[model samples]
Structure formats: C-alpha cells, structure tokens
Target chain A: MGKKTFIILAFQISLFNFFVTAQSLPEVKAHQKLMVEEEEKEEYEFARESKNEVEMVFSGLFLGYKKFISSQDGNTCVFTPSCSEYALMSIKKHGIILGTANAFDRLTRCNGLSPEKYRKDPESTLMIDKLE
Target chain B: MNIVKEKLSVFFILIFSLLGATKGHTQDLHQTFAFANELIESEQYERALLTFHRVLFFGKGSYQEEIFHQMGTCYYELQDFENAARYYDLAYFAEKNDSIKIELTFKKTSSLLLNKDYGYAQIELFNLPDNLNPYFSQKRNFYEGITYFGLGNFTESEKKFLRALPSGNAEEKEEIKQIFKNLEKVEKISPKKARILSMFIPGLGQVYAGDWRNGLNSFLLNAGFAVLAVQTAFQYSIWDVAISILPWYQRYHMGGYMGAERIAYEKIEREKGLIYSEILEVISETKTD
Candidate 1:
C-alpha cells in the first residue's frame, strides 16, 4: 500500500481500538450498601428493678409463685411467653392496676380454644403470644 | 525411498520432543502472570488468587505492585472487601508511578467503603494529594462525599457531592441537591401521638400508624370486653363485675395503647427504610465521572 493510505489505515485502527477500550471500561455505579444503623437488642433479665413498692411486692410474689406453685404445676401453658411471665411483664410495664387486669385477660385467652388467633412459635408448639 | 521415510520420521519426532521440552521448562513469571490473568478472565477468582500468591511467593520484586493489584482484584471479585482493601493498600505503597498510586488508593478506599468502614475510607481519601488530574480529583470528591454520607454528616456530604460534579453540569448538580432536600421530608410516625390516640379511643393509634388489621382487632376486643362488663354488672353483683369483667376491660384497654405506640415506632422505621432506598436509587441514577 502507498504511504498515505497506510497512515490513514493506521489512524483508523487506533481510533477503533480507543473506542473499543472505552466501551469495555466498567461503568461507574453507586454502592448499594445499606446505611441503616443497627440497634442493639437488650437481653431480658428477671428481677429487674421496679418503679414502686407495689411493683416490687408483686414481682416478689410472682417469683415465689413461679418457684413454688407454677414450677410444680409443670409447663402446662400453651402460650410461648407463659402465663406467669406475661403477668409479670404486663405489671412491670403498665403498673399493678392494668398489669393485674392484663394477667386475668391472658388467663381467659389461654384455654386453647381459638388456636387460629395466634401464630405457632417456630421453636416449639406453643402459640406465639407476648405482651403488646 | 524407505530409508528417506525413516529419516524424515526421526527429524519430525526430534522437533516435536524439543518443542514439548521447551514448553515444559518455560514456566516463567510472565507466563504465570498470564495464566493467573486468564483464570481471572474466566471468573475463577479463587484459583487466580492462589496463582497470584504463587507468583508472589516465587518471583522476584519485578511484579510486586502488579501482583498486589491482581490479588486485590481477586479478593474484590470474591467479595472479601477487608482483604481487598489490605492488598490494595499494599499495591498503593508498592507502586512508584503517581497515577497508578492514585488509582490504587481509590481502589483501597472503595473496598473500605464497600465494607462500611467509612472512617477508614475517609482517612484513605484524605491521604491523597490535593493536586491531582481533574478526573481523579472529581473521583476523590465523590468518594469523600460517599464516606461522609455513610458517617451521617449530610452537610459535609452535600458540599463534597456538589464539588464532585463538573462546574458546568448544572442539571446533575440540581438533581443531587433535590435528593438532599427530599431527605428532610421523609415520612415518620410519631409514637407519642399514636399512644395518645389509642388512650382516647381503642386502636386509633394503630390505625394512625397504618396497621388497620391490628387496629380493628383491638377495637373489637375492647368493645367486646366492655359489653361483657356491662352484661355482668346487670346480671350479677357489682363485686362480681369488679372481680372478673373490670380486669379484662382494663387489660385490653392498656394493651391496646401500648401496642399502638410500638406499631407507630415500627411504622416510622419502615418509612425511614423506604426513604433510604429512594435516596440510594437517586444516587445510583446520578452520573459520575
């Protein structure tokens, strides 16, 4: 080929190669990492501090009942949180008045009558119900 | 004719044997690098990483920077961001060329960012010289903006993001500013308001929080308990009503308000998640150099 023709062909090949390289370059994209700050879960502990004397007394009585009466009764409750613990939690959170009432409400609901009302706990056969 | 054929066969066999021996003996550093690169091209990052390590173990200091860079790429492909960052750091230190060093630093920072180590990414980004090519300077600003965003400094992030774009690209800059502006108005439910609402009327809080099913259930349960209490008081003595029906009424009433508060809090969290995803979408769609 003549020199001028060869130069033109060389220039075209170089331009083609440049375009190919540019096309093959990885596209810039924003990272999709989640920016949500994870909140640490607090561990549940029995015998946590009570807000008043009434609550303290109730907690002590509940603990005594669990150790003596409830323990001897065997794990008969069908609810996952169990009846006694639920009562304690309700009282601790809502105070003695409403807590006692909630405890009674839980007692009425624990008769295994309406199984479809609660989800089944995956860990065990107990129905999944907890303090709201 | 028979003798000529035998000689020709011997000559061909000698040539073939020599070629095979030469190929077997020439497992050089360049060839090893080529093989590792081929493995990387095939997406066999694990095997490529091993081969790169072998090259690093056996070869001299000739391909040190390149080997580290290759190893970083392999780790990046394997989704091992921590090791990718480490190798990229090594490559950055090993490289003498200013451009390659800048690229290595960017890679290291990117790896750190992907691992959500924003603090480290910021530090790496700050280590780069102020005087850089325009492309790299824009990239540095972009990375700094992302680092600050991850660290929850929106004002600084916005400033960095604004700086990241070219001075003349008004449309993209405005789009970014709009995304930041929308961040302030992200929908969030007030747990206190929800609780107050439920206290006045059973399940109202839950409904306000967009949990209609739970709200309906709460309303029905509380209303049912109230009806039962009234019926018990009429049929039996007030003492019987107080002992049995009153407790149930109180329990459901109190539980309803508490549950409303929790539901509202959860609703806020869900809304925040959606806003975050929307922000990410806008960012992904925005073009960067």
Candidate 2:
C-alpha cells in the first residue's frame, strides 16, 4: 500500500509539472515604447568666442545693438530670420564685407512689394527669404 | 492505514479534476481567436493585436503561423510597414506549406515596397525560387518591375513589367509597350537650358519654364537693384554703388537662375510621376478586365 501511494503521488506531481509548463505564458512585447531619436536644433545661444579682432568687435556691437536698441524696436522685420539676426548670421558665415551687402539686400527684400515671390512661413506668416 | 489510504484517494481525485479544468481552459483558445477575429472585422486593430498576441502567449503553438500572419495584417492595417514586414517574415519562415510561403513572401515584399525600401524589396524578390507557379510568378515579376522603377532603372523596369503581362494578350502587351516607348520620348524641359536663359536675362528662364509670376518678381528685384546702383553712383559716388548695390544685384541674379533650374527639374519629375500613375492605372484596368 505504501509503494502504491508513492507511485500515485509521483505521477500526480509529474502531471502538475506538465500543466504548469503549459500554463506559463511569455510577456507580450510593448510596441508603444518605440525609441525615436530626433535631432533638434537649439535656436538660441549667447555667443561663440570670436577668434579674430574684427569678428570680436562685430559680435560685441551686434550683441549691444540687440540688447539696447533692437529689443525696443519690436518684431517688425518681414523675413522669418529678421533683419538684424540675418545680419549676424550672414556676417558669421561670410565675413563682414559680403555679409553687410547680404544684410542690406535682405532689408530691401523685406519691403513686402512682391508677396508672390516668397513662400509664407507657416509659423510666422512672414516671407521666408533666408540667407542663401 | 485506512485514514491514509482515504486521504491519498481524495488527493488523486482532486488532481484529476484540476487536470480536466486545465484541459477545458486550453480548449477556449479557439473561442479567444474567434473574438480576436471579430475585433479585426470591426477594424479595431489595436485591440485585435493585443488579443491575438494574448492568444499567441497562452496557446501552445497550435496556429503559430496564422497568428503571426494575423499580427502582420494588423500592423499593415495600422500603416506600420516596418513591423508588418517583420511579422510577415516570421510567418513566412514558420509556415510549412509552399503555397502559403509564397503568399507570405509576396506580402512581406509588398510591405517593404510600400515603405519605399525598394532595394530590400528587390533582394527579397530575388531570393524567391524561379518559376514556382504561374500566378505567383506574375506577381513576383510585377513587384520586381515596381522595385526597379522606384530605383530609377527604367530599362530593367520595362523588361520586368512586360514579362508580368499575359503572353496570350497581344493587344494589351502592345499597349503597354507603346506606353514605355512614349515615356522615353517624354518632353522634359532642360534645367541647364532654363538656368542659361535666366543668366542671359533675369526671370526669362522662369517665364520659359511656365512660372511667369516668379520670373516677373525676379526681373523687378534685379531692376530695382540696378536702378539703386545707378542712383547711388550719381548721387554719392561709384564707390558707394560698388559697396552697397553690386552685391545685392549679384545675389538676386544667381538666385534667379538657380530657382529657374529647380522649377524646371520639379516640373519634369511631376510629369514622370503622372505618366507612371497612368501606366499603373492601365495595368490595373487590364487585370480587372
């Protein structure tokens, strides 16, 4: 009787193990948390330290103009980059001589004379005449 | 001894009963799949995906291929072609039957094609065995042609597309042949010519390219700068004109030519796309007929 009981108990334990194995379910993968890394441009920074004396002077003047005069002038430029900002960028990109000329051209183009010439920026509804 | 024997008998009965219950639960997998299918039918794909995944998790590999295929369909419906292609690939490998594998391969290629991964789609089509059956062969040829077309290999695309047509249908084949020939003779405006025209005269290239308004704007801007230079030269000096006005004139002049070239290129690309769509329409009509 003791031997018979041991065999029955062992058989039951095996059956229990089988059922447990069948019941074990893997966790579902979460597709919602897909990793998407986007490169976002930082729009504002203080200034880059200029290597040359001329660039240093221009940067200082531009910063001073922005802080004192341009701040009080309001957002009046028709282009998305604005005139003063375009001047700073163009100068930074192409040095003072050509950059100054580009800035003056931008000012002339800002006159809203030919609205059909440029696409309106979706955000600002301004003519999108960015420096080439 | 009597008490021990009675307790052991009760335990045995309990174990049997539990096993029966477990079996009954296992039987409910089919019903669960039906419920998931209903969710799919109702277009509740997200819910259906979760439910189907649940079935896959619990069921003991009973319909693994079908479940994977269903999941791929769900992802496809959601327009997530990347995931759809992945699941279809899984289904393709898991399936045992040849016909079903062919179908899954076609589906996987389609997902890749729709995602605009033409290179990968072409590779997948090439991996398929040559000439398994007529119906799938035509499908493979058509898909290969589309892949080649997307890759801008027009000659290869033409060959594959012609092969995809029925051999017996001479009239339809001739019509498709004529279309491809017409595509070769398509009158695309030369971007270089447009640029040269603009360089010769501000906005002339744009006018020739059918964008008169932009051309007018370019001409006016250049003329304004020219007038400014002359006025500055007379009022102040030629030095002031050189410093202030010349740069503006030069930029607008260069920009006008470049813009004309871009406009011409875009118009030609648009025309090509329209022709491609027309070809596809004709092919689809022939198929339906």
Candidate 3:
C-alpha cells in the first residue's frame, strides 16, 4: 500500500524473472546439444564394411577365368568345328540346305541335324559359342 | 483497495510471463534433442558426428560424458579409428566406473588395432586389469597377434596367438590350431624363393607354392606372348612388332610372370581358408549330432 513497499515488490519481481530466464537458457542449449550427439551415434553404428567374403571370392574366380580364356593357344582346335567359330561354320555348312523349309518350323520343330542350322547361324551363334 | 488490486494484477501478469518463457525454452530443448536422435537413428554418421560435437562442446552440462561416448561411437562407425580411440579415451577418463571404463578401454584398443597402431594397442592390452573378463582377454590377445603379424614380428605374433588359443571346445581348439598352421606357413614363405622361382620359370614360383592352375596359366600366357613377339619381330614390320612385341605385349608378359607369383600366394591363402571352413563344418556337424 506504501510507495516503498511497492518499489521493493517490483525489484523482487524483476530478480525472479531474470533467474527463470537464465535457468531456461541452459536447458534449451543442453537439449540442442543432445539432439546433435544422437545423430552422430546413429551414423557410427551404420557404417558399411569394405567387401564381403562371397563378393571377394566371386571377383577372384571371374578374373582367373578371364585370364585363362584370353591366353588360349591359337593352334588348338576342337573337332566338331572350332568351338569359337562353331556357329559360323555350321551356318555355312547347313544354312542353304535348311533355307528351303519354313524358317521357324525347320529350325524349332525338326530334330538334331535340321535344328543345327539355326543353332550354328553365325549371327546368333557367335556370341553363345564364345561364352561356352 | 483499488491500488492493492492493481498491484496483484501486475504480479499475476509477471508470474504468467515467467512460466510461459520457461515452457518455451523447455520445448525448444526437447525439439533439438529429438532432431539429433532422429539423425542418429537414421545412420547419417558424419552429420550426427558434427551434431554430437556441437552438443559435447557447447551443450548443457548434464550430458557431456554421454555425448563424448556417442562421438566415439560415430567415429568407430565411420572407420575413423584414431578419432574413435581418442574419443573413447576421453569418455573413459570422464567416467571411471568399472563397466563404462572397461567398455571404453576395449573400444579404444579395438580402434587402435583397426588404425594399425599395434604398438599402442599392445600397451593398452597390457594395462588391462587381471580381473577383466576372459572373453576380453581372448579378443585382446587375438588383436595383439594380428598387430604383430602386420608389423612382421611373426615370432611375437605366434606367441600372442598361442596365448589366445581357446581350450574349452575341441572345435575351437582345432580351428585355432589351423590358424596357427597358416601363420607358420606365412612365416616360412621366403621372399627370396618366390623371386628366384619366378625368375627361373615365370610361374614356377607359384607352382612350387602349390598353385597349379595359376602357374600353368602364367607360364602359358608368357610363352604365348613371347612366341607372338618373336614372330612379330621375324615378320620385320615395325607396326607388327610395335603392336605385338611392344606395349601390351610387354605389359602382359610381365603381368603373366607376376600373376604366377600372385597365384601362388593366393593358392596358399585359399587352401588355408578351405581347411578352416572344413574344420568349422565338422564342428557344426558334430554339435548337431
């Protein structure tokens, strides 16, 4: 009710407000810190290892096979036409003879010798022959 | 009475404002923490690491130790072993409780090993208390052996491996023994012999080491190239020789020779792996029966 009492009340209110503000500042800062820390933790846990064992084995096998095939001696030849050139030679040997018949029927419906024409056709056979 | 009412009204207003400010601060903190948690859970390690560093250095006081440990975890995940070791060391220093300290120490040692800082890793292992768990001891010894092996201290490596050998189960014992044999072979393989045999027969070194397929392939490849080179030379065309005798021919010839030795080395490794797998399979079958 007095002027002195009123002044003291205002001062006390100001001090309480300052203290509350200061306390909350730290809590807010701390919360931000915690969020960042958690993100880092997640990253660490999920890193990938370099190479798996199965992948390594497959790589080695493929490389070895490639090296072997590339180094084949030119002189050595397979009996039933060179395996590398099988389709070409087979087409030259059989294509004209089989060309008279229905193309799909002669190729797919017929048994061994007739189907061999389509099988050895250079355009289709070249790639498959080398793979084998 | 009117004056008193006005003063009370002001006081209530101040109280409400203070409460609202505090609540807002708390909510902001909660949101930040949640965001960091989401990043960590999502496995964005590098970003999470930066976030953690921000928290550890500039965040609230209560979570300092936890933040440091999490930073170490991030480094470990990223395969930054040196940094991981450093962070783990700090974490351990901050909190010396037995469980936390032991775990941190193990992590530090593992990071050091991964970094190929074997000397320091060994020192850390030596300092581990006798009361440390046996499983930890086994792992420590295994890592120590790997470090020694990497450093070319095969004698020390063998000793460490012997110490780590498990005696509890027949299968485990056999597996360890097989590893021991591989280590012995690795030690016995003389670089001189490898070089000499490689010089004499191109791929003879690999064949001597039991890599038949590789040795044969190497020998055939080199011989093939050599024949091509000679034929190209006899043909007396500069372009022919250049194409077949030089460049790719030389590279492939040298490669074939090196391949022979590499094949030999790989053959030894493959054999060891096969034997180990066989032992493991036997153990698993025995256990099942």
Candidate 4:
C-alpha cells in the first residue's frame, strides 16, 4: 500500500481498538460482610462515650443517613439501610416531637443499618460486624 | 577433658543467648502486628499496609504468609485490587498447607478479576483444582464464571455459573440464579447492527439501544450538521465543509454509534446487577432475622 493509505489504515485500526477497549468493562466486588474497617472500629469503640453517641445522633438528625443512602448503588438500598437510615432520617428531619414518641420504632428500623464503606480514608459510624 | 568441657559450656551459653534474643524479636514483631491491626480497625488502611510491609521487612518469623494475606486484605478493602492480587499471589506461593493455599488462591483470583487483570485471573482458574473441598470447589467455579464473564464469554460464564449453583450455599445459589435469569436468551438489538443503522440514520442506533433521548439528540445534531455541510458546499465553498461542518458531523456520528453499543451492553450489565443486589438484600434480611 502507499504511505498515505497505510497511515489512514493505521489510524482507523487504532480508533477501532480504542472503542473496543472502552466497551469491555470491569466488575466491582462487593465488600465482604464482615470486612471490618479501622474507622468503624474506632467509632464503635468510642460510641460508648457520651460525646460520640450525641455526635452520631446529631449527624443522623442532619440528613447524614440520606446522603449515605444516595451514595451506595444510587437509588438502590437493601432493607438494611432502607429501613434503618431512612426511618432515622425521616424522623429526625420531619418530626422532632413525634420522633421522641416514636423512638422505639426508629431504633428497630435501623437495627441492621450499615454505613457505606469508603474507598479511602474516611469516618465510619459503626463496626460492620457489630451492625450485623 | 577439662578444656573440652569449658569449650562446650561457652558454646551452650552463646546458643541460649541467641535463642533468648530470637524470642524477644518474635515478641516485638507480634506487638507491632497487633498495633497494625489496631490501625486497620481504625480505618487507617494506607498506614496499616506500610506497617505490615515494615513487619514483613524486619521480621523473618513464621507469620510471613499470614502477613502477606493481611496486606492483601488491606489493599482489597481500599479497592486497590492490583496490589491486593499481587500480595495474595505472594501469600498463595508462601502458604504451605493445602487448605490455606487454596484459600489464598481464591482471594488472588478475585482480586485479579476485580482489577480487570483477566489474564492472571484466567491463569489462577486453570491452576485451581475442581477436586478441592466442596466449598472451595464451588467458589472456584464461581470465580471462573466471573472471569469468563469479564472476558465477555457469556456461554462459558453461564456454564460455570450453572456448575456453581448446585454446589453453592444460599447466597451463591441466589447470585447464580439471578445471573441465569438476566442472561436468559432474550434478544437484544445487536450493538453492531445498531451502529450500522445509526451510520445510515444517525439517531437510529441510540434508539435501538433504548436511549431514546440520546437517539433524538443524535438525529437532530447529525441532520443539522449534514444540512450545514451540504449548504456550505453548494452555496459558498467546500472549504467550510472541510474546516468546520465535516469534523463535527464525523465526530458526533462516530460517537453516536459507539455510544449506542456501549449503552446496550451497560443496560444489560446494570439489569443483572440490580437483580443480584435485590436478591442479596433479601438474603441479608433473612440472615439478620
């Protein structure tokens, strides 16, 4: 082939290869159920302290649970977070007076509530195993 | 005889002191490992990996394999599967026991697969035996299926998943079932066909790929560019077509076709993920209950 034709052909081949590579994708592994993080351990251990307890409660009150739910799998929550975090957030955001009355139900809802694991260094609210 | 006795006593003293120092070294290493574990628990994963590396470098203890495994866990948690797989590979080779070797290999396979290092994952799958303990065997097949799926060999993936389903526990069974259900031979518009269709009529490929809004946008954008290019060529000069209109038209047209194929594959993958995750939720709930 002529030099110009060879150059054109090479460019086309490279472009096609780029598109093929882009189409073939990788899988994301789910975190193993008892995969403990240091942050969660710290949070759980410090949770017994009155200061940490109030901080967690205050965070939940500030729609932290809502943000947590949105971050994981985007619009998909298994009952674990759906039940616990949503209830907590709903109660805290909507009803200060009724939230106090509905404390028992609220506690029951988030029984298996798990905070999302971070891809890097970040605060974790509870030990996953403890939540489980 | 007295000279010989004195020499033997001096040698024994040296041996005992060496033993004592070795014991102390081991204890210090253990304490360091314990501290690293604490750091890991606090979510200081990067530091923990460094600490584990330090322990590996300074210590020549029996816990070498275990330390490599721990490093793998830290990297895996960070989603740095490349490093995780590397450490797991090291651990797999170092592990002497068959069961532990199998376990580390399994972890290595997953880390490789997740990192999109399919070549290594494939090699690990081949190295793995089907005659392992029932649990490992099932896990082995499942990871094999995952590797195949990553390579987009759907038929092999299906076959492996079928094998895994029979031997898997409740969770794997459900996972396999969802995969089977999602990959059920429903006809999807061929991405190649979509690309061809859109090559002729710019938005058709996106429409076929079920991206209706994009399809319409692509159609309008390409049609508008085509009109401008034609008008420019006829009314003023081919220079405008060459300089501006043609490039935009070609770029978007190519993008539209490629995007359609990409979206098609992504839609199927996304649906499968949803099915799997929803089942996982139920399983999690049942376990909790």
Candidate 5:
C-alpha cells in the first residue's frame, strides 16, 4: 500500500473510535441521572412516610383531650376515662393499638373512683360524678 | 496505546464523580442528624420531635438509640405519660447496656406512676433490684403502701407502712406514726355508732370526732344535696329521684357519718403525728445548737 493510503486508513479508524465512545456517553449519563433521581425519590418518600408515622403516634396521645384547658391555671387532666378512651380509639385507628394497654391501666387504676366502699355507702358514688 | 490511555482517563473521571456524589449524600445525612441533636439538647421538643423522627426512620444507623431515648424524654416532658411509657419501653428494649436498661426501666415506671397505673407501677417496682437505691426503695415501699390503702387492703397496707417505718427519717417517722394511730382508731370505731350519728344529722359524727371543720362542711354539703333531692322528688323526676334522692342524699348523709368517724380517727392520728414531729424537731434543734 502507498504511504498516503495507509495514513488515510489510520485517520478513518481513529475517527470511528471517537464516534463510538461519544455515542455511549449520553446513554451512560442518562443511566447515572436516572439512578440519582431514583435515590432522591426514595429518600423523600422515606422521610414523608416516617413523618406521617410520628404524627399518627403523637395524635394518638392527644385524642379526645382539648388542646387547651379552660381553667384559669391552664391545667387539663388527660388521664380521665373520656380522654383515655379517645386516645385508645385513636391508637386503634392508627394501627398502633399496642399503646393503649398501658393507657387503659392508667385510667382505670389511677383515675377511677374506688369501688370498694361504694356498696357500703352508695351516695359516695358522686365522687366521680363530676366527669359526667 | 495512546487512544486507550485517553479512554481510561474519562472512565476514571466518571468514577470519581460518582464517589464525590456519594460523599456529599453522606455528609448531608450527618448534618441533618447533627441538627436534630442540637434541637433536642436545647429542649425544643416539638421541633426536636420532627427532627428526631427524621433521624430515626430515615437517617442511617448512627445515633438511633440516643434519638429514641430523647423522643421518650420529650413525650414525658409534654405530660403525655402514655406515649412516654411506650417510647421508654422501646428504648429499654433497644438499650445494650445494663445501666441504660435500668435507667429506662425507672423512667418507664415513673411514667406509669404519673399515668396512675399503680398496679403496673407496683409490678415495675417489684421487678427492680431491692438495692437499686435507698431513696428509691423507700419511695417504692411508701407508694406500695398507698396503693394497698387505695385497694382497701388495710392489713397489707399496714404491713408495708411498718416495713417502711424503720427506714424513714424524722418526718417520715411522724407520718407513719400518724398513719398507725389512724388505723388503730378506725379499727376501734363502732360501725353501729357511726350509722346512728349519721342518721341523727348529716355530719354530727364528724363533730364528735373533733373534725368540726369537716363536720360543718359535710353538714352543708349534705343539706344542699337533701334540698335538691326533695325538689327533684316533688318534681316527679324519677331519674332525679334515682340519682339525687336514693344515692346522693342517702350516701352523703351516711358518708357524713362515716366521714365524721374517719375524721375523728384521723384527727387523733394527726395530733400524734404533730407531737412526734415536735419531739423530733426538738431533738434535732438541740443537736444542731
């Protein structure tokens, strides 16, 4: 082969390799972009779902109790049966019913009027009547 | 060979870019976690709760236990004892060290106590080592006595009181003495006499017990209830009769009598307590002087 033809052949091969590499660049870039986007979406979703879980858990604690007490001192009792019942209902609705067991024990054991002397003096039942 | 080297350079650049992006992502996560911790330390609970949730459910494996424990503390401070108890239970279960476990258990027990779950509180107290702390032991026994009294297990209550008495300080000793004296007087008061005095007037028995203040208060309270009962009965409101008449009047009148007897016994005990305290104070002052 002549020197000029050989040189031309070498240039043609180099040009071919350049196009091939350049052609794959966009595809690689697209793939990387897609993966990054997916990672971001997943992270966002994880954060959103986690926030909802926390809110649901918190709401379960405040259910049935007013946000503010009308009393002058701003002290509100949340362990009353009505408030506790609401909390339990919220917990059940949120599929977090496991939190209600302790709450129930608290209401009945701590807040309810003692039933021991109720039979002896039925009139004393008014102790808890204020709730009604 | 030169063309191959050029291609290799581009490949290396791509790998380095990916590594940089990953490094940035991790740094962002760390920053977010740090910010959450700062909020917690500053006691911005509501805001901290949001950040902690981010760390707990979204952040990687760093500081998860600490975040959860902080969340429980937030709930406790908010007076949401139920939620506090739940989170403390979670923290207790997740804790690796014995000291953390014990501390979490104490917090859980405190939440239960605040929520008024005396039964479960008792359960938790019993589960703790007897030598957890002398102060805790004394408080545990005292609360146990209170729970027994609330449950009307007088014998058991007295037993607990006696157990706690020996460990008590001067103030506690006086308190225990008063409780013992009251128990004795309650035992001595005749149920028949209480019923009789109660029938005579709304709160005459209380007056006999030297609890004139309580007697007067009971008298007025019962008289008010009696008036309301009479009005409701005449109004032909059977519901009112059922509630206001049978229960309110009868119970208050009877309770007045019982209250008087109880107060009489309580007064005697209180006087003894006062005397005991006075004697102790005298001894203490003399020693200090």
Candidate 6:
C-alpha cells in the first residue's frame, strides 16, 4: 500500500511536469501580449501609387489647356457633365485641389481602400517545423 | 509535547509543498503567456489571437485584461480595425484597475475611429469624461475632431480641434494648427452643378470634375451610339435606331449624367478622406514619438 501510494504521487508529479512543459511550447498561443512587426508593403501597391502620380500630373495639364466644343446631337454622352468636363470645370472653379482630387478619384473609381482584401496575414515560423 | 511538535512540523511541510506547487503553477502560466507572446513575435497573428483568447477562457490567471488587450493589438497589427475595436472594447471593460482604464479607453476610441464608426467614437469620446483627465481629454478631443472631420461635419470638427490646441505641447500645437489650416482649405463640390452640366453633355460632367479619361470615354461611347442611330436609321429605318442605337445611347447618356453628379460628390469625399488620412498619420506618428 505504501509503495502504491508513492507510485501514485510520482505519477502525479510527472503529469504536472508534462503540463508545464506543454504550456511553454511555441505552438501554444495564449493571450498574445507583444507587438508583431509589420512586413514590407507589396510591390504592386507601390507601383500603383507611382502610376497614379503620373496620371495626376498629365490629367491636370490636359484638362487645364482646352475647353470642349459644342456637339450637334442631343447629349450623346451618358455622364451629364462627363469625367473630362468635371475635371476641367472643377479645376477652373476650385483650382488644382479639386482638380487633382477629382482626377485621383477617377483613377481609382469605385475601388475604395479595401482593407479586408489587403490585410496582412501572419507568417508561419520556421523555428519548429511540424512536418507531416 | 514531542507529538504536538511533530504534527506542527508536518503541517508546515504541507504548507510549503502547497506553496511550491502554487509557484510551479504560476511559472507554467508565465510560460504559457511567453508562448503566446512568441506567437506574436513569429507573426502568426491568427493563432496568437486564438491563444490569447484561450488563456482568457480557461486560464484562471490574473492577466485577463492583458490577454484581451494583446488580442486587440494583434487585430490592430493585422489592420483589422473592426476586430481591433471589438477586442479593445473587451479589454476596456474587463480591466479592473482605474489607472489602466485611461489607456484602454484611448485605445478603444482610436480603434473605433479607424473602424470608421465615427458616430460610436464620438459617443465613446464623450463617455471618457473630459472633466477628469486633462491629458487624455486633450488627446480625446483631437481625435473627436478627426471623427467629425471624417463625418464631414467640418465646422464642429474644427471647434473640437481648436479646443485641443491651447493645451498641447508646442510641436503638437503646431501640428494641430496645420491640420486646422488644411481643414479650412477643404472645399465642397456641389452635386447640383455636376448634374446640370452632365445634362447638356454626357461626359462633360466628368471632364469638369477632372476625370478626363472617363470623360473622354463617356463622350466617345455616347457619340458612338449617336453615330449608330444616325447611320442605322439611314441604312434600314428609324426603327433600326431602337434596336441598334437608341438603347445603348439611352443607357450611357443616363449613366453619364447620373455618374457626373455622383462622381463629383465622390471627389469631395475622397479629398476629405485624403486630408483626414494625412492628419491621422501626423497625429499617430506623434503618438509613437
């Protein structure tokens, strides 16, 4: 009976030790209490921003130079004032702030900054590979 | 006397053993937290988030607030502002200490702002009781101003921002003033004018609004329809205009006019957003500084 009780106590200690060790493993995530470093921005995002810059410059000049002539038919165009008309007129009215803004909006029309689509996913660590 | 001493000695030994076990348990908890922190370090955010939550759910540890706050940070890192706001809110309410409440409230408010739940953030700012904590109050007011700016209530936003200016450090004050100046510079584009302009020329509205590419495209499309209607009428009959040209013309013409007003208004909104984002960047950078 004495031997059996001792064995039981030893087993319990072993189990407790195992539990502590398991808690410390890299895979066991519990309440993340630290900062995760940000990864570099995607290449395409940078490229798109650069292209937008170029468009902004050219569009400003193009709209600033000429006014559209009157057409014969009843408004053939769909957009009432149209994109070019808006750009030209807004620039003429509000200066480049409105003009540049209008051009930028048009450049990425209907595509709001889609955080859901662009959110960064966390990378798996190579520290301990659980190879199947 | 000896028997009594022996019993007392055994009781002390039992107490020590219990204390040792308790220490071991606490150490395990520490290791668990460390492991979770490591997950964050590894950039395994989703798993890290889950682990933090698990610690809250099962671990009867004392750092529940810390865990939830860490979860908030993880979501913030992911740029999932909605989730970050939710978790920050969780952390705010779960926090027991008054000292930490201010920090949590600030985090929750910012997260709400980033989530674009401007209305809620405004309310949360009000709830912070500006009368009590002057430091957080000033910061809160600045963010409140930003929220109003985001909502396009520029006047009210400017008022809130002005109130914050008198109290901030000189550099911060200068930053706020710059933002204020920029705020005044923001202009509204009238939708009515855009519609009227587009009425005469389909794509003219977009051109006037500064979208020359789409403007040109709109003109060409409608012009193509016009040409089709004229040519098809000459080729077949006026009835051919219906099948070939009128339908396409009508769609684009209507779209162009409506789109002009919509897109012009969208331009104003976009400009406001850009300015707001710039201000936010400056203020947020100042936070790190």
Q: Judged by DockQ, which candidate is best?
A: 1
| lDDT tens per residue, model 6, B1-289 | 9999999999999999999999987787777788889999999888898778767665875687788889998997787878888888888888888757777776777677666788888888777754644445555666667678767687787676555443233575477567667646437466777778887987788877777876886788788778888888988999878876786677768777787877777776666656555554444433221
Q: Residue-wise lDDT of candidate 5 within A1-132, one digit each (tens)?
A: 999999998876544422221112221222121101111111112112323665445543343122211110111232323444444444544445554654554456443356453233244332231121
* Candidate 1 local Cα displacement, residue A55, angstroms: 44
The sequence of per-residue lDDT tens digits that candidate 4 reaches over residues B147-185 is 676676767866765555432145545665665666564
* Candidate 5 residue runs with Cα over 4 Å from true position: A1-132, B1-24, B60-62, B129-197, B205-289
Q: What is the lDDT of residue B144 in candidate 6?
A: 67
User: What is candidate 2's lDDT per residue for B42-148, written digit by digit as tens?
Assistant: 99999999989889888878778889999999998898999999999999988999989988888888788778798999989988998655556666777777778
- Tens digits of per-residue lDDT, candidate 3, A1-132, equal 999999998876544422221112221222122111111111211112214564344335434444474342222222222332332223333453442232333234323434443345364342122212
- Give the candidate number with the greatest lDDT: 1
Residue runs of model 3 more than 4 Å from their true location after superposition: A1-132, B1-19, B22-54, B57-61, B74-83, B115-117, B127-139, B149-167, B190-192, B209-214, B228-251, B261-289
| Highest-scoring model, TM-score | 2
Q: Residue by residue across B1-289, what tens digits does model 5's lDDT show?
A: 9999999999999999999989987787778778877876787878878877887665665776777788898898787889888888888877898767767776777677567676886687677776644334444554555445445466776566444433213554455556556556545655456546866886677666665665676677777777777788788886867864676466556556656556555554455434333322322222110
For every model in order, the fraction of real contacts preserved is 0.06, 0.00, 0.01, 0.00, 0.00, 0.00
Greater lDDT among 1 and 2 belongs to 1
lDDT for residue A42 in candidate 6, whole number 0-100: 24
Clashing pairs in 5: A123-B251, B206-B260
Residue pair clashes in candidate 3: A35-B36, A36-B51, A36-B52, A39-B40, A39-B48, A40-B48, A40-B49, A42-B40, A43-B45
lDDT of 6 by residue, A1-132 (tens): 699998998876544422222112121121111111232322322112223454556454543332222221233322323444455445544556866687556445423344343323244211121111
List lDDT for all candidates, in order. 0.76, 0.74, 0.56, 0.63, 0.56, 0.62
Clashing residue pairs for model 1: none
After best superposition, candidate 4 residue B11: deviation in angstroms? 23
Tell how far residue B132 is off in model 6, in angstroms: 3.3
Model 4 RMSD in angstroms: 21.0
For candidate 1 chain A, which ten residues in a row score worst on lDDT?
A18-27
Deviation (Å) of A64 in candidate 6: 26
Clash count list over all predictions = 0, 0, 9, 6, 2, 43
